[model samples]
Structures are given as structure tokens and as C-alpha cells.
Target: MNSHSSDKKGILRRLRRIQGQVSGLERMVEDDSYCIDVLTQISAATAALQACALALLDDHLHCCVADAVTRGGDAAREKVDEASQAIARLVRS
Candidate 1:
């Protein structure tokens, strides 16, 4: 198995930042901040979340999926199928 210690740290950091963004959004709404400002922050949070998801997907492709593909068996097909479905969902989002 591959160790993604650094990847994990980066992801956790991103999540923490996203959490702070959400809190700020909440405060903005509570304080009746300008509509466009709130909307802009929301967009920023959404983009950050999507970026984090892509990073996780990239890690999965490079590690688990790559290993399964190299094995050339049922595991490979399953991993490919799994990755395809994940990609489709992300695209739909």
C-alpha cells in the first residue's frame, strides 16, 4: 500500500481552511453583509472543496488504481470501474 502522509496533511489543512471560510460566511449572513460579498465567499468555499476532492481523486488514481491496473485481473477492472463512476459524479457536480 502507498503511504499518503503528506497528502493527508495537505488535505486536512485544506479542510480546516474550508471550515473557516464557512464560519466566515455564516457570520457574514448573520451580520447582513452585502449580497455579492456573501455570494463571492460561497463561490470561494465551493471551489476550495472541489479542489480538495480532485486532489483526493488524483491520489487514488496514482496509488490504488495504478496498483490494481498493474495486477491485470478482476481487481483492475473493479478499480477502473470505481474510478470511472467517481469521475462521472465529479463531472456532474
Candidate 2:
């Protein structure tokens, strides 16, 4: 029933990589790595998270929003509104 069900496995794999990046970042900080080195790792982690967000957004639009629009009526409006809010949050981040 999930919007990203088709690619759930792929998404999870990416998430796990991102999680590893974060853990590495924490280790870098704990080990007192050079400032620039820590910053580079942070950037990598941030980019990974952003990519994950975008992928999920694409899946939501193609699956959940598409289905809602096809059904028509209030469900479509709700989905559109929900998607808009999600986009806004993503952009703000």
C-alpha cells in the first residue's frame, strides 16, 4: 500500500549507506579529525540525505499522487495539498 513499495528495497539500501555515512561522520568528530575533513564528510552525508529525500518525493508523486488524481474528488485535492507541503518542507531544508 505504500507509495514507494516498488522500490522500497532500493530506498532502504540507500538509507543504510546514508546511515553509515552519518556514523562515520560521528566517528570523525569523536576522533578530532581535521576541521576541513569533518566538514567534507558532513557535506557528503548531507548530500546523501538530500538525494534520498528527492527519490522518495519522486516515488510519492508517481504513485500516491497519481493514484489520487485518477480517483478524483477530495482525495485528489488532499494528496496534492499533502505533496505541496512536502515539497515546501524539502525546499526549506
Summarize candidate 1's per-residue lDDT along 1-93 as a digit string, tens digits: 247533988888999999999999999999999999999999999999999989988999988888899998999999999999999999999
* Tens digits of per-residue lDDT for model 2, 11-69: 89999999999899889889999999999988988898899888888889999999999
> Which stretches of model 2 miss by more than 4 angstroms?
1-4
Q: Top model by lDDT, which number? A: 1
Local accuracy by lDDT, each model: 0.92, 0.90
Residue 39 error for model 1, in Å? 0.6
Give the clashing residue pairs of candidate 2, or none: none
* lDDT score for candidate 2 against the true structure: 0.90
